[model samples]
Target: MNGLSGMREENERLEGEVSRLRTELSQAAAGDGGGEKVNELLGEREAIQAKVEAMLDALAEIDPEIAAAVAG
Candidate 1:
């Protein structure tokens, strides 16, 4: 695959991971004594989201149309 396709796949994977982490975080919040776990999940999700944003930025620089399509 080319850079655009590779980045799109990576972005999709990262987004899926973020969604999973959100679910886990929600479950942890609903339980007792899961403060630490919740924090960890939040941090992980944030990092992954940041990575995705950076990748989008880079992709936008390379090809705005492809980036827009991937982002949507």
Candidate 2:
């Protein structure tokens, strides 16, 4: 696939992962003795978020309008 398509797919996958992590984090917070798990999930979520931001930045460099729409 082309760079744009590849990036879009990666972005979607990362977004899915972030959503899943959010769910797990919620469950961990609600369950007993899950402090460690919650922290780990948070860390992972942050990393994925950073990656998403970076990808968006790259997209912006390539096409500002497309990037804006995608970011929305």
**lDDT (0 to 1) per candidate:** 0.86, 0.88
State the lDDT at 50 in candidate 2.
Answer: 93
Q: Which numbered prediction scores highest in TM-score against the true structure?
A: 2
> What C-alpha lDDT, on a 0 to 100 scale, does residue 6 get in candidate 2?
94
1-72: candidate 1 lDDT, tens digit per residue: 369788879978897998899899999999999899998998998899799878878888998796778678
- Candidates in order, TM-scores: namely 0.80, 0.81
Q: How many backbone clashes does candidate 1 have?
A: 0
Which predicted model would earn the best lDDT?
A: 2
Worst 10 residues of 1 by lDDT: 63-72
Residue-level error in angstroms, candidate 1, position 11 = 1.1
